[model samples]
Target chain A: MSVQHVKIVKNVLAGNDQTAERNRARFNAAGVLAVNVIAAPGAGKTSLIVKTMAALGARARVGVIEGDIAGSIDTEKVLAAGACDAVQINTGGNCHLEAGMVQRALDDLDLDRLDIVFVENVGNLVCPTHWALGEQLKLCLPSTAEGHDKPIKYPEIFAVSDVIVLNKIDLSELVDFDRDFFYKAVRALNSHAPIFEISCRTGAGLSAWADWLLNQHPHLDTKTERLHHLSGAPGM
Target chain B: MHELSIASYLLESVEAQAQELGAQRVLAINLVAGERAGIVDDALQFSFDLLTPETLAEGAHINVRRTFMRFHCAPCDCEYSPKVGNFSCPDCGAVGQLTADGTELLIESIEIET
Candidate 1:
């Protein structure tokens, strides 16, 4: 077999990046602090976000954009948990939520009346991390049942996460989960991220996490004062 | 794996590049796959072969350049390669704090026969 040489080129999908940038600008303009919550199946992402919305409901207005391959249970749960508004995006069979999907979902949310908007990504660590949904914070949920080596095994997801939530800590002792090993794994991939050990079922260690999230309000940033100029009315 | 999507992107890029260079058929495509990217080389190649047929890149060879994961010590400023599944800075024992060099999935170059 003869080897044939071809041209070399480096070009990313500029269209996707442009859409993400526009989403970011729109989110900033609406003073909506969006977060992309990612994790594996059975990681308690919905439970954690529901608990967070309940805890922060009195302090701040919260909205939710639930992305799932099928079923509206998460959307119903978010509404029942007392979010100002909740919308669901069904990706059919897609493993992750893309920027275009999020843009469509944004039209269904009232951007002005919310202080925080959480995009609960589809439960798969690999696919979600590759897609940017215009969220300022990228949160990862690693349940104790998933083992301590997840951060090392799936380094890309952990690397992009601004915060790591170690969920199902209530069962830490029942299982052979080692806190030190998990911490070491996370630190190896991401050192600056603050890891919150919480139990969504018991509502343990959630207040501190909620407080940290509240502090990330766009209005709190002096450099971006324009974020606070949003009207209280719903945009969508 | 997500490598299927990356392969699709590569095929699109190669087709576009071939059109830009006024070439009718693509011969090979070069890609860099970092060790930490979680992509299976055999799986990607299989998917690429299956997906590229009947397209402009039919029967194109795929060349993957593997790069090892490297981290820098924050305190000592020493760069070190991490052993597979090991993520610590060997020089300062400061943990892996530097940005990762691996985990890259990009189309580097494409060859086309005019």
Candidate 2:
């Protein structure tokens, strides 16, 4: 028996990362700001999307991509909440949404008509942090009810997230969430991103959240923006 | 579930590399992962076992070595792991940042038989 050793240093996720870059290029071509929303189950991802869409109104053209383990319930809600268009991606049984799956979903959405696309990632903190879907921003939601130590337990997710959304603060009175501990822990993981504390059930802190969304995509304010509604360009 | 996906990528890359070298089958592979890489070794092995059935990498052994998260505390100029779970320097208990030592996931080498 003859054997040989071949040495190669390559990232195991190279294929996925390359595909994500392609997805990002596609989104850029249409001037769509893509946001990947990740969180643990029941972290209020869908509620935030719904509220953001309603708040943006005519301020921005928004599309929704609902990712679930199996079902179209979130898609139905986004459509009802007035998303310019929406795409539903069911992971079947996967714990997370990979770049290839996001690529396939992008084919169905009219990216030219949208300013920002929010991908509601399949609820799982650990798995979703590894995959990138060519998104310009990654939003991570950790409900205060879920406890403050989440940033420590799942540090990788918070470390990579661009925006940390603290949801369900409406129950801060009832729940024993330590605000100082959570911020300090999150700072250990990530120090640059702004942490937004909001209650999706009430409009307590959504104005600032929506304002932050607008700042992410400044093209909405520029007249030079290649808007599908204002221009004759077709969706790529 | 993520391991299964990772194993698929590893197998595909190994098979492609093996074929390029005119090898008929692959025997084993060495994978190096850093402390912050966030992968489970047993889960990766289990997925590799189930995924290599019909590929050129069938029956191949996968060896995963994890490089622990290393940090250097500047406050006391000490180097250690995050003992307190938040970059708390083990030597002097000062907060530090993630070092480059154990943050990468790499496919080191592969063995194949002709």
Over the full model, what C-alpha lDDT does candidate 1 score relative to the true structure? 0.81
Q: Model 2: clashing residue pairs?
A: none
- Which regions in candidate 2 have their CA more than 4 angstroms from the true location? A223-236, B84-86
In angstroms, the error of model 2 at A6 is 1.4
Query: What's the true lDDT of residue A146 in model 1?
Result: 87
DockQ of 1: 0.47
Worst 10 residues of 2 chain B by lDDT: B91-100
Each prediction's DockQ? 0.47, 0.69
Error of 1 at A34 (Å): 1.2
Backbone clashes counted, model 1: 3
Docking class of 2: medium
lDDT of 1 by residue, A1-236 (tens): 33346546463344455677788888898888999999999999889989998777567778899999999999999888898999899988778888888898889888877778899999999888977788999999999988888877888888878999999999988888988988887777787889999999898999999999888786834323333445333332
lDDT of 2 by residue, A1-236 (tens): 69998899999889999999999999888878899999999999999999988877777788988899999999999888898898899888899999999999998999877889999999999888888889999999999999988987887888888999999999887899999888877876677889998999987789899988888884664523345446766543
TM-score of each: 0.87, 0.94
Worst 10-residue stretch by lDDT in candidate 2 chain A?
A220-229
